[model samples]
Target: MKATHQPPTTGDTTPADLLRGAALYIERHGWNQGAFFQLPTRHRLAPACAMGALRIAATGTTDSIILDDVFTQVLAAQAILANHLEPDYDHTTDLEADLNFEVISDWNDDGDRTAAEVVTALRDAADTWDRLHPTGGENA
Candidate 1:
């Protein structure tokens, strides 16, 4: 005799289960394709928004004006993930190292600071954000 499989009810689903499902979906469909998937109505919007923010950050395009708040959230997500991987990981120092490798030959000098300096500033902002929102499993 054949047996039927039953999907877990919504009440039985945990956040980790949802995240694992999402990660699997992304792995199968690729990040861009995964981002286009319609988010479930009952789910919190933060994950969807963070996915969008990650897309923007990955593009590295300066054409669109991303708001500071959105960027901060993205950085916060990055810091949180990094912290999870390595407790001693310093996101700010990493950002500075990444910026140091950037090619800014075409970039116009605004008489303010170099690209690496900008990264340092962003790191500072991210530090402030991390302090405000410490990493916790309860969020998951």
Candidate 2:
């Protein structure tokens, strides 16, 4: 299922926009496997995998991905990503739940998983975020 929403281009791109962009990026290029990430410079516009695209969207850089980093933006992005992966996941309520990278990797690396599924997941997650936030994920 292809997402009809286009990536936000305005200066105020929100978290949901980032997710959408990730989906569009994967759609335009292709899914990457067997690596954590590759810069858009390398793979046209696509990151190596779902999580890599999210990280790039969050950090706007190819720096090392430390999933536990306390940085504000990454943490916020991770929360949104985590919530999408598992609806019941709440850091305060369920510490044992798999957070960002693990869950995304498991799904992305599944042998039968196709790029379309990954793109759909990202787009669906973004739609979920929009519905929950209602403010377009800027204040989320």
Candidate 3:
């Protein structure tokens, strides 16, 4: 008989899970995720507070991620990292120290694997970062 040691489950914070979370947000809000979130666009993901949602709709922004109205920028940051480990940054000079984060990077050719694998890797990375930076998501 072969001795099989199963890898411990991350218990749900994987990137695949995070991407599903993004979908959930869309479903919950009854908005089309494809229409709002453009894969190739480099738009900033600013979470909409209850009041912020009003402003987001009022302003003409084409490419933006519309998440739950309650999530804050802090949560969005964590979510984006967890869902897509290698995410878009407004600029290249951003540093972990400045954001009080430890640098973690994941690279994959877009067609090399399934989206699930990519998302799971990112989820693991973001979870690791969150463990280090435990100051976020309380109210976000």
Candidate 4:
């Protein structure tokens, strides 16, 4: 399945949607360890990793700076996903804790990491987002 990056405003695509869509993307495209995306062509998108999926799901582009805005909107959700990747993650002092990018990168780059695990992390993150905002508010 190819990911179509629709603007969030068009269909009530919440932050949770971004997380879930990313998981689904990874499930379909498999995973890549060393890069954010793979097989880039003018025709389709193939997100290669967890963060890459998130970026594609959120903005449909590879410019990573956009991720800062994405993370700011879904911080706790990110934290939940990060904890799944690295159980010992200490958000308090971690250099990139709020975004959880460091832990995610380390986890994905690990030789033992699997695509299923990354997909699970994204789904769990979406679940956490739902629980935190039961009314579908974007406050978190």
lDDT of 4 by residue, 1-140 (tens): 24555445334556678778778878876677888887766765565787787666666566656655565544544555676666675552335554587777788788998888888878887786688678887533
Question: Per-residue alpha-carbon lDDT of model 2 for 30-133, expressed as tens digits?
Answer: 67766756445642554557766665555554467434432344445545666677777663123433456566778788899888988888888778778887
lDDT of 3 by residue, 38-109 (tens): 232234343322122222322223224443432233233444443334455521232332331222222233
Highest lDDT, which number? 4
> What is the lDDT of every predicted structure here?
0.33, 0.61, 0.33, 0.67
Question: For each candidate, how many residue pairs have backbone atoms clashing (under 3 Å)?
Answer: 0, 0, 5, 0
Assess every candidate by TM-score. 0.29, 0.67, 0.30, 0.72
The local lDDT score (0 to 100) that residue 32 gets in candidate 3 is 20
lDDT of 3 at 60: 21
Identify the runs in model 1 with alpha carbons over 4 angstroms from their true place.
1-28, 31-53, 56-65, 92-140
Model 4 regions more than 4 Å off: 9-12, 41-44, 63-71, 74-77, 86-99
Using TM-score as the measure, the top candidate is: 4
Q: If the candidates were sorted by their TM-score against the true structure, best first, what order would they fall in? A: 4, 2, 3, 1
Could you tell me the lDDT of residue 70 within candidate 1?
A: 38
lDDT of 2: 0.61
Off by over 4 Å in 3: 1-20, 23-109, 137-140
Residue 48 in candidate 3, Cα distance off native in Å: 19
Query: Clashes in model 2: which pairs?
Result: none
